[model samples]
Target: MNTVPGFRVISLPRNTTVRVHRRSATIVLTLVVLALFVLMLTVATGAYEITGNDLVATFLGGGSDMDQFIVLRQRLPRAVADLLVGAALGLSGAIFQSISRNPLGSPDVVGFATGSASGGLIVILLVGASSVASIAVGTIAGGFATALFVYLLSSGGGKVSERLILTGIAVGAMLASVNDYLITRATLDDAETAKAWQFGSLNIISWPHVIPLAVLLAVLVPLTLTMSGPMRVLEMGDDSAHALGVEVGKTRVWLLCAGVALAAAAVATSGPIGFLAMAAPQLARKVSRSPGISLLPSMAMGALLLGAGDPLAARALSPFQIPVGLVTAALGGLYLLWILTWRKG
Candidate 1:
């Protein structure tokens, strides 16, 4: 294994070493490089076919005004927004999976996204609160509430595992029903807007959505990363974690809070974009071949997934681009089915 600047490229026979595990590090770096290449390719793809040279010039601030405008204002921001949201969702999913010790314990699986959607709908439908902040707050409230409900339902004398997954699925179904009712009962205009929001979209991402999400990620991701030790401890089972000086309950709570916050912020910023969060972490862990969840790799994998998906969505139909969420949801649903069946057999 050769170590490069801030990264190591791992060779075949993988060993289990703690400090900067070479295999995972190398694989992650490789994925990141590939992701960047894909991102640049995507930037060049659009309604107006911009050449690689033009893309490079535009990136270097040497292209025509129109090129700059298209690249910088329209496409670039959308790409960045996708990266942020995807990374957030990926990290959240990874954290949740690690904490719950179950692959099925995702925000969508646990009803956090559905719950957040319900909250956002309440603001849009009943309270007449159309502001972004209101929606963001509602999403956070909804996600945390759903998590709390699941926790309470699954908690027994002690421990949480398979019960949590069952509880989450049930809660998720209930919240999804509530979300549907809210949408169906609203006016046509409201219903349309809610539909778009609920299905998720990166359509109207302005500075407002991008800036707040960026800031939140900057603060939360690092904080969550610092809790990795406790998270790993929790994976060893609650009693063992407690025995190992890890505050079992507190660690779970912190991870849950952080995961909910990340998911809610993403959902609020771009509605509950299906599968990016859920899929990215799983993909990252699989690709990296890590024993437990790999947070940083998951985030990178997410950014890569969305970074690629955005361009695919942009150019898939030319002038009329389908929302990024729908594209991801379709693919995600298929991938999820494959994983579930593969696991079963």
Candidate 2:
């Protein structure tokens, strides 16, 4: 086999070959290391202040009980959840952006996140459901339903990307109104809870929140990685992908399902953390300089962004804390403006 200068190729027993991009791989590794550093910092910088030594000792099962509880029971779960949820959003963003061939094609930008939020609000405000599992189901259902609606609306025009995005924005606006109405109709306590969830906080995260999202990602991430090749192929347009023996329709459906599920899982866990999904893949692509959205790097970038944001949100105000979602939204808003102006130029 001929060698590519920037990619390393590995041969399998059955004569299969895998090519890995060196730069992308390096970027992913760097992002992962940074993510781990952020995770440790998150676990350490809190009211209790577990030093690096204490953190290592606690994880190794040698720290005092108070240190263990503060680290393990309280901070660790939130930190882990931040990483897992961020990875899910990042990967989901990559899938959507690649599929649509548009950098603005993230789940949040196209309304899936809002749809998921709508579902969760329904469960929380109308049905009075309090469990994470129930909300997760609602969010997933809502995401899939919204995807279907947008696809059907976009299919008629033969401009799926443009129509899908526009339709999603419209639908998302309507849903936002609905979400607000539901909150108004709800009791004060329920409204407050729903409002807080909408703002997206990591404060209440526990093992229960972390475990399910981690398990879901364990399945979804591998499935997404497997589909990455087909996803990249589909980027060359459906005609090319079809000529190459790819099942264009089937592949698209599966990709959309996986993307929606990832986004929904993140929303379920973190109440639709804003802009991480949209920003992570684009940032990853810029840093890696990959021709298209790279899944692993995007996932790593997402984890790093969220992991870093959480600590800032927690400590930025000292006595008062901001939601991580707000931080991402502020940053993401600036990024959006910059990208738009830069692209125009």
Candidate 3:
């Protein structure tokens, strides 16, 4: 056995056990490779019936014009969007849960998802906002507003507690009610449009959404990676972090904002697509055997969950495609049940 600077290595006759950090990195790397394979699979298999050779050839710049148009123009963009959305939500969820030091302390728990949905609904139902740009703005504003509300109520303790959880649930329920009321006010056509978007389909995804999402991830990716070190320190408790020269209050706020940015961006693109933020971190922790909330593992899991689910959703009903959100929601429900029962037992 040998010890490295940041981690320990254990070598045995049959196998080896590396420390948590290295193990987590290995898990993430595996997930990334799997995600790439899945991306190619998704691009190749779709309703549009492109032969494998043609699809691969198109990817390599040799397919016919129609195959090129279908694969390049349509399939590739949605696949990229799914990956970005998953990574963003996964990273954001990991940060929030790690800082909150509670499994329940995710952006979804704090009402950011509902807040974003409320924002989009308000833009659509109130302002008759149909353009993508307008919806994106409203969704982000709503997320920020929700975070502000949750923070104001939950900040006294300097840590996430049951009160924060309860308050967030209350606020989320209220926002959901607001969404219902807004839907009531919408015209039938607008309501249909809003309903469809709310369910979260990749059909709305194209160049416009994909470009901004790429840029958003490019910025937040580095910021979240930088924050992970301090976040680990923060997990020890407020007094401990402060003693270690980490500004507890400022760090908490910045982490919350950063988490909200990632969550809000995902919500904007996918209409509060559920489950990834809530489940990915737990799944990552379990799989990587990490001592704490490993952000890289969570991001990789989120990307894999959502990215792979997209094609499954497409094929679930054969000729008719189901929204990927529903698939994740169903999976999340099962996960929640298992955790609850397991914990109780």
Candidate 4:
């Protein structure tokens, strides 16, 4: 067969596949090493001195009951919680950022986290519910409803637009105020509990938290990964995306739902940990040096940051034991300042 003139046969590997795999490997390795280091540090702290041998022995299932109790029952759950929360936030942030095609389009920025927090707070305050199930349900509903509202209000003129950002900010601020009110009205005991949640703590986490979150992640994280293909396409500007056969609205909704589910689950379990969502994706992009949104790497960064940050916060404050959220909030605040200043100049 004769080849047609001016037609060159060239095989090109998809950039998306290569980028996803390379970024995923690097990020996952970094997260694993950091997670192990954090786990060791966590086991070493507190009343008992858990040395290298102790950690090894405990993990081998050969340590004393007391050693096992401290490692398994106490520190381990908290460490696991930190990792789970980090991963959830990282995935959620990447999804939101990609969908909105704005660096500031994270769940934290778009009010999903705040809305989740508000819903969890309502359960805590009005319903006086303390179970993880109740809180999770409330958070999922609240986060989803808020995003839908933001989408709708922003679409007043036509399709989903930049106005969604503005509406989300307004909605988030309002929900935040309500959260404060709930906190203020809580009884002393309830207030203490609510405060811990609002500030994002891993102190009281247990197997109960671990089980539900593990199940949620097993389902939601994979869904988030699968949706990344559509998100990447959607990032190429809306009109171009639609023209290329991408269902823009449907993709956005799916991404939003997955992101909200992940964020809401984290909020229900750990009470809206600070900036992991926003910070993780930014850090992942920097590390991977990949253009556009990097979901897998962002997740790895989230796990690394939270898993490591918890222990650093623990040691920095000693017996006081600062909440992980406070540490991240301070870090996030610095990042926010830098971003604002950079924009101004």
Candidate 5:
């Protein structure tokens, strides 16, 4: 391991290396503060308007019934959904990106989200599954199935990163087309419902959805964080990882499954919120200058982007709310361009 001045890199047993530094603490802190600000603003500024002071009063149990209903039952749930979805997307993205050692290897790009969306769409259009529980089951199943397919296809070739990425891309493209076609074949009402899937939104978030997603994130994010060491090693390439005694096969399978679960949870909660999983890790690495994608920073960036983007999407065109998915796509697209230009220069 290489270390420069003011930095210490620790190599532990089993080929785990730890890097310690505080250079980006302030930046992360600032982002966290900003996220909190955006979240409160989102909760307060809506159709059933509640100002900052009123929001605090409601939280402390003083607001009227309407305000309480709006904040507690509606706006609060949506905000929580945004945060949970962001965290899931960010963590999922970091896991896949590190595992593949490629920026394009995100759940959105890789077919997990597409697969999940397709599954949800099928349940809605074909089986008439409208209940939360059934939809969740279908969505998660689709994502897992897609991951298995990708793994199987790439396994025959030794799970090469490039090959897996290409396979996933091909699968994702096919699934996306299928999703559109399914929409076309559905009835008018079903088609309208499916349109929301095309552009992910948080307007329909309820306590039931919020609770499951929060519970899943509570379990999964911490679980994924525990593999950071192995993830770091695995990203260093196959030979180095094996030399470090990392169980190349087992670790990859676990991380890949965890990533699919995370991505599936987010998609199930908020539709295929495109570009979030792809953008969050890349943005974190850019800001922190970490050797590889840092988990906490990526989660924070994802939360900040989605949390803040919601309100901006609402207000960007007065009296007309754009979908959060569109906001993320536009924002992520600009960031992608900047990265490309910066790399070229």
Candidate 6:
């Protein structure tokens, strides 16, 4: 019934009110538009170019056979995978940062991404499982196991945020070594396959890869969004959140599970693409100028970052292609330097 300067409040049937920040909404919309533009560019600018008209026509089932095959059968799946995986990483990063109350509280920074990779490697190299379903299972199992280990290790200390970060980093380092050992122990062919996967590429993506991820995100994204308010309340501290009727321990556990699942899904799909998880939430926060993490904005920013990065990875070297993960890692390193310098300044 009332409107504020920077937010719009809507009255609900049960005497409840929802306040939406105007600027955050604007920024989310802008990011979404940019993501769409990047998607179009990605589909249009490959070895066989598809003009704007042809791209639209292909989508509408009206393009020539060659155009349709290029757009529908080839590029669209990769673009969709980039978008979906980026969203997963972004949402996962936002959840972790919120839980740890640290900018660096990301799965990639912690141990979960490495754990997922370790799981996939064990299946691929040791058990010799080659199916996508099997790899996804391994990654999820590895991620959950790592999360449990980190939480148990960190539970003793009252400062969970600090302990979680430190434990995760240490665990991640060990897991990286294990992954390397696994690769080396395997046959040359298996090692080569694992190495390429570890670097993370969208080149091998297709509808089969995209469908399962899309379905999982369809369930997880909405579920995560519903917990956004409770997550923010938890950030206020245990005593305060308890006073506000939030079950601190239970909420934290559920949140961590969701976060780990999201990160694992991205890894299962794209082999631990780095920095997108760590950077998307922080970038979204800065752009929206919001004090707390906003899930929608983070997801939008993640999609936009990967969407933009995919084209560059494919076209930056003309004939030669770089894995999307390497590009993100390079950019993420630069982002870290800027953040450190900006803080000191």
Q: Candidate 4: where are CA atoms >4 Å away?
A: 1-24, 44-46, 156-161, 340-345
Q: Best by TM-score, which number?
A: 2
The lDDT values for all models are 0.82, 0.88, 0.83, 0.81, 0.84, 0.89
The list of candidate 1 runs beyond 4 A from truth reads 1-18, 51-65, 341-345
Model 6 steric clash pairs: none
Query: What TM-score would every model get versus the actual structure?
Result: 0.88, 0.96, 0.92, 0.89, 0.92, 0.95
RMSD of each: 4.8, 1.5, 4.8, 4.8, 3.0, 1.7
Predicted structure 3, TM vs. truth: 0.92
Task: Tell me the spans in candidate 2 whose CA falls farther than 4 Å from its real position.
Answer: 51-53
Badly placed stretches (over 4 Å) of model 5 are: 1-20, 24-26
Q: How many clashing residue pairs are found in candidate 5?
A: 0
What overall lDDT, based on C-alpha atoms, would model 6 receive against the true structure? 0.89
For residue 277, model 2's alpha carbon misses the true position, in angstroms, by 0.7
User: Sorted on lDDT, highest at the top, how do the candidates line up?
Assistant: 6, 2, 5, 3, 1, 4
Query: To one decimal, what is the Cα RMSD in angstroms of model 1 from the true structure?
Result: 4.8
In candidate 3, the residue pairs with backbone N, CA or C atoms under 3 Å apart (3 or more residues apart, or in different chains) clash, namely none
Per the 3 Å backbone cut-off, how many clashing residue pairs does candidate 1 have? 0
Candidate 3 per-residue C-alpha lDDT over 1-345 given as tens digits, one digit per residue, 9 for 90 to 100: 566555666565668453447788889999999988898888888777888788778989999998988888888888988888998889988987888787777777778888988998898888997787888898999999998998788767544555666778889989988998888888999999888888878875887888887898888888877777678988898788889999888887888888888898888888878877978898899888787899889999999988898888978888888988878777777877876876577
Residue range 1-345, candidate 2, lDDT tens digits = 787888889887888777888999999999999999888778887878667887889999989999988899988998998889999999999999998888889999899999999999999988899798999998999999988888787765355667777888888888888889999999999999999999888888999988988998989888888887889899998889989999988898899899999999999998989888888998999889888899999999999989988878888897787888888887887989977986788
Candidate 1 residue pairs in clash (backbone atoms < 3 Å): none
